[model samples]
Target: METMIGLPFTPKVLIVDDKPYDVKILEMKLREVGCQVAIATDGLSAIEETRKFKPHLVLLDIRLPDIDGYEVCKRLKNDADLKEIPVLFISAYGDVTDKVRGFESGAVDYISKPYEFEEIFARVKTHLMLRSLQIQLEEQNKRLEMLVEEKTKELVEVNKKLAMLDATKNELLQLVANDLRTPLTGLFSVLDSLIYEELKDQLTKDQLKAYDKAKQQMLSTLEDALLLTQIDVSNTDRVYGEIPIQQVIKQALNNVRPIATSKSVSIVECEAKDFKIFGDQNLLTRAFTALFEIAIRFSARHERIQLQLGTFDHHIELSVYVIGYTIPPDYIGTFFDLSSSARLNILGGELGIKPAIVHRIIALNGGSISVKNEGPAGVLFIIKFPFI
Candidate 1:
């Protein structure tokens, strides 16, 4: 009630009543308690006084000269800007129905016309205190919401920058891998020949054997690295064309023919005659080469390596099998992860020969590669490609 006790600003009150005596008594009572008061003789002028005074609270009488208090309360409550201001109904028509209608009209409280001075003060004090608390809570909530929204925006910006940095890092890795391409291929070809030539000559046979094996492993590893790099760095808009699976097999067989002869290894081709697949020819060629090379290296002397071709669900698949070696069960799960290259290199002195690169290339082409141990000593590498 003491509106300007410790502050310069005074809280204003609006009193609306048709009876002149009632209006004068309520105004004097409110001003006695240090609250600023405005008087409106009817419902129409009450709304105008509200706009002009912007009172903290409104005390309205049920009967008015122009309009009833219920209609006035409804209009005030429905308005966007004025709805938040609390209205207390002071009515002479003391009926349960009138009280219910006044509440339905959105007046926060209803007071009887033959009102007690103390009861009126108590209700006003209670409603004003509650309204002040509500205003404080709304202000606090708005501040909290603004803080949360700002933090969310900051987090989004940070995530965006992190994603861009990750993309740039991958691009740099691909560029480095591409630069290694020419030398790696040349080195692999030389290494393949080295193993074949050393095994032929009797003079440096035993000593050169390990070096030759190491060279072969290194070559294979490089090939894997190149393929993995292509998987990440190469454009996805691929040149899809007809590729002869048989020709790829033949070329791969020709490349490893000398090694097979030296080891007395036999080849069993169950390759589909004139079988064609729709994909990037060069990529398919590299995939076939890797499988064939693995088959040749791991198979026993004089043991037959099988090249099989088939189709399922409109997808073409090429499978190569070696008879003597089974992939280690412990290394089965991560057999195609690039990180496995480090493990393989540590174990066998060559990193590039790991299937990590082949897996990446296959995945990039929307294809998949898998291995299965058919029997005690049979290892199958199955590659599936889109029918395209």
Candidate 2:
């Protein structure tokens, strides 16, 4: 068992000297100021007392019986267990060379023979306080390291769970999309037969017209649903290549030409020069078709819907602006929203899923689609594609 010769407020100190009177005076004074003293009259005894007593501070006399104080301090400092113990020397050698030699041999402080008790105590207290602060800081660093390690482990587990959940969500979306498309296909086939084939003669003109409208609406909805499953964000299927911007625009214009002509809405195409984008061509064509259809449907009779294409920085912009129409400012924000039904009253029918799907397709290709005001004149739909 370890001995507790030291009091709670006192630190153990080792004092080495050959003079009994000097030793008695220092021992009494140090003990009075809350220091537990261990006396060693020789260098060998001082080294032994340091290992045994584990003193926090040591006061050694430079001239001793067995070995000098410098030799004792060096030996104590060399030992692994005793190296951190602060050593102070009391000596008659007051020259600069003696003090430097004492410090180089690992004495923290070297005091001359005629020293005051207050000065000794002050130096001892300062060194002890510094050592105490060092120990506390080391402990705090260990605790902080443990906390960082634990938090990193927690984050790793959370990321793993999130990845698994994402995979499950994507799988469910694919299965439901496949299930819904099968019935939608059957309905489209039946509508085609009833409107154009077997039942054409038996149905009245009003009934035929109604069936045709229903067929068109269902076909439009089904087309959008199929497009959703094709891209779906998680789907990595891509047939990306360099596709000319004008070629896709021409195909879109051709598809929407009949609808535009029927509404007496003329399109003015200010063509883009040598503009190319790297993406799926078929999807891009559909996006352009949606923009053209929206323009034609909303334009007033004899109104000119302007199509302008130009390069801006690293991206190309294809804009469709209506010169004489302005949608409600509030509805402009909701136009690109997938669930908004405000377009139903404006279009005289539901807007279907055209606008939102086009937005998604552009975003999937690392591009953007926006509807914004064209000053006092109508609104503009801008489609952006970054050049590859």
For model 1, what is the error of residue 298's alpha carbon versus the real structure, in angstroms, after optimal superposition?
14
Candidate with top TM-score is 2
TM-score of 1: 0.58
The TM-scores, one per candidate, come to 0.58, 0.60
Query: Who wins the lDDT comparison?
Result: 2
Tens digit per residue, CA lDDT, model 2, 68-142? 988999999999988988888888899999999999999888888688877777777776666566656767899
Q: What is the lDDT of candidate 1?
A: 0.76
List the global CA lDDT of all models.
Answer: 0.76, 0.81
Residue pairs with colliding backbones in model 1 are 220-353, 221-352, 221-353
Model 1 lDDT at residue 158: 96
